[model samples]
Target: MKAMTYERFGNADVLELKEVPDAHPGSDSVLVQVKAASINPVDYKVRQGHLKGLIDTVFPVIPAWDVSGVVVKPGLDTPEFEVGDEILAYARKDFISNGTLAELVEVPVRTAVHKPKELSFEEAAALPLTGLTALQTVRRAGVSAGQRVLIHAAAGGVGSFATQLAVLAGARVVGTASERNHEYLRSLGAEPVTYGDDLVESARALAPEGFDVILDFAGHSAMQTVPDLLRDGGIVASITDHRARDVYGGQYVWVRPDRANLAELAGLAARGSLKIEIAEVFDLAEAAEAYRKLETGHVRGKIVVRV
Candidate 1:
């Protein structure tokens, strides 16, 4: 199998597209014929060696989290999937050693879910990590109907999903993005707010009392605007700040994969209650370029790589 891999963490420049041996599944894992995969900010961060501590993977790593593929083989006791089943998954962090960047990937059954019939493999590939992150954050914040929710980086991967999910939950959604993405955000059921100086004021003008729940995906240092935009009793969750225990007295979200939750998200997509936006698509050969775009953090939605 051909795979894109990094012998050592440095930058996208260090990634190489080359032939690699196929991966075999463990007792409770499934071997998937990867049809599509998506690039996340974490992919680039790991490429650049920024997340070595968090990911804790060795060198020569296949870097990808979101995968949509068909099961070619199932290991012993893996009852959730069978050969020939179409599925989507957010591969676990500890297993980054062999990822969906390859023509095939083998993962534990716990992370896999049936793909939404309404979504193509490419679109389904784009949802897992980002979708799961948004779902977990909203659930952690106790987002409910009639409350106002604010999502930072609303035009990006997780933000796009978060906005839609919050709205579906009946929250008045407000999202921050550049001027160009205002309409797109609004289409997702969010009142668009721009980021920059007085960003808090922009959100405040929309909801004078502040948002009842704030989910930030704009990175740790960029989440400084969250506190002011949140209602005093509101909950705040940031993919940027996982250790926000002291920073936000409410809840802090640490995204984890849950097969049941992934299934629910798939159900939402199947029913048209959730939307998966693909801002860009790249071939497996263009994995480097995909990672580059994710690092820029300007993509309107997710960037997928077709295997």
Candidate 2:
């Protein structure tokens, strides 16, 4: 199979297109003919060796985690899917040796969920990692109807999803983005605030007493102000851990692949209760270019590599 591979960890320059052996399915896994895969910040972080503590890579590693594809074969012990079943999954980076930046991949049945019939492969591919991250952050913040929820980096991958999910959960969503994304965030049902000196004041104006929940995906030093922007007993969750320990008075959010959650999200997408945004799509051969675009941090939604 043809795949995007890296001989060593570094910049996107290190990735190349090459032929690699097809992976075999394990007893509890399924081999997917990958149709689309999304790029996450973690993909580049792994390439740069920044996630060494969590991901130990060998040379010629394939790095991608979010995938939407069809099952070509299901493992002996797997019954969740069968041949030709379309599915979306947040692949467990540990078992998939090679990531989704390939023509095919083997993912555990537990990590794979049925794809939403309402979405195309590209849209489903974009949902896993970022969707899960945003879902977990919102849950951690305990956002409820009528509460004011503040989301940082409102236009980026996870942030975009967070805004929509928070709004759906009945929170008066407030999101921070550049002026360019303000309208977009509002479309997602959020009150948008531009990231700048008066961000706090702007947010305060929107909710005089401050937010009831703060979820920060843009772990910049600015996240440290989230606590001050929250009402007492309100929660705060950070995807990037802006070291706001002093003011958190809440929980830190770390995303994990939960098949049940993915399944629920799939249902939501199918029911129109959630949305998946695909900013762009690149052919698998253009993985390097995809990484370059992702690093720019200008994407309105997710970027996918079509396998």
Candidate 3:
């Protein structure tokens, strides 16, 4: 099987397309024939060794976690899935190797869920990590009907999902983005505010009383505005910054794989209540290029790599 492998932490230049051993299912895991995989900020971050202290790296590492593919075989203990089942997963393991960027990947049943027929493989591939991150943050902040919510980076991959989910919960959403993405944020049901020195003023202009919940998907000191933007008793959640909890008495979210949450997201996509936008699609051999585009940090939605 051909995969994008990197021997050591570095830039996208380290990624190489080469033939590697084929993957097989292990107990409680499934071997998926990859149809598509999506690129996340973490993919590039991991490639650059940003997560070295947290996750041990093995040589010749395959560098993606999100996958949508067909199951070619299931492990003996995996009664919930079978051969020929189409599924998607955030296939992160305790260690870094055997990822989904390859033609074949071993996905644990704990993280895999059935892909809805309504989603194309590309769309399904785009949902897992970002979708789950958005869902977890929103739930942590207790976003609900009639509440005022603020989302940082509202036009990026995870922020896009968070914006839509908060809106569906009936919250009035104010999202931060550049002027170019303002219209795009509006389409996702958020009142768009431009990010800059005047961000707090702009957000205050939209919601004079302060927001009931603030979700930060952007890490560049996004939590600095929490004191000014959140209501006295409101909650905050940040995926990028620990200050949301350590300093602000809010939650710092690390997205985990939940089969039920993935299923709910899939159902929402299938019902047309949630939208998955594909900013660009690249072939497997061009995955390094895909990472470069994602690192640009201006993509409106998800970048996918088709196998």
Candidate 4:
């Protein structure tokens, strides 16, 4: 099978299209014939060796965790899915090899869920990692009706999902984004605040009483405002900044793959309540170019590679 691979960590230039051994399912896994895969910032960060201490590097690593495809075979011990079932998965493992960027991927049943019939393969591929991150962060913060919520980087991939989910949960959301994306954030049901030196003041102007919950998807000093923005007993959660937990008495979120949460997102999408945005799509052979686009750091939604 052909895959986008990198033997060593570095720049996007290190990625190559090459033939590799085909992947098969293990006892608790399924073999998926990939239809689409999405790129996350973590993909490039992992390629640059940023996660060296957390995840061991395996040579000739295939990069990407989000996949949407059809099951070609299921493992002998796996009974949740079968051949010809359409599915999506956040196919992350302890090691950084055998990822979802290949034509064939081995996905564990624990991380896999049925794809919503309403979503295209590209849209389904875009949901797992970012969707899971947003869903988990919102739940961790315990956002509820009538509360005032603030979301950093609310126009980005995970932030977009978080914004909508919070709105659906009945929180009045204020999202930080650039001026160009303010309207986009508003479309996701958030009141937009331009992120900058005036961010805190701007957020205060919207909710002078202080926010009932704040979620940080952007790490660039976003946590510094917690003291000024959060109401007493209000919760804060961050996916990017660890100081939210260590210093601010908040939670630092690491997204975990859960079959139940994935199913909830699928159900939302199926009901036309959750939206998946595709900023761009690249062919399998052009995955390197796709990574280059992702590294630009300004994409509003997810970027996908079609197999």
Per-candidate local distance difference test:
0.85, 0.86, 0.94, 0.94
Q: Output the lDDT of residue 90, model 3.
A: 95
List clashing residue pairs in candidate 1: none
Give model 3's TM-score versus the native structure.
Answer: 0.99
TM-score of each: 0.96, 0.96, 0.99, 0.98
lDDT of 3 by residue, 1-307 (tens): 9999999889999999999999999999999999999989998898898988988888889988999999999998999998999999999899998899999999999999999999999999999999999999999989999999999999999999999999999999999999999888889999999989999999999999999999999999788888899989989999999989998889999899999999999999999999999999999999999998999999999999999
Distance (Å) between predicted and true CA of 163, model 1? 0.4
The local lDDT score (0 to 100) that residue 219 gets in candidate 1 is 69
- Residue-level lDDT tens digits of model 2 in 1-307: 9989888878999998999999779899999999999999988887888877765677778888899999998999997899999999999656324888888899888788999789999989999999999888888777889988888898999998889888889888888999999889988999889988898788899989987888888876666686569888777788788354445666777789899999888888888888777889999888899899999988889999998
Q: Model 4 over residues 72-186: C-alpha lDDT tens digits?
A: 9999998999899999999999899989889999999999999978899999999999999999999999989999999999999999999999999999999999999988988
What RMSD does model 4 have? 0.8
State the weakest 10-residue window (summed lDDT) of model 2: 242-251
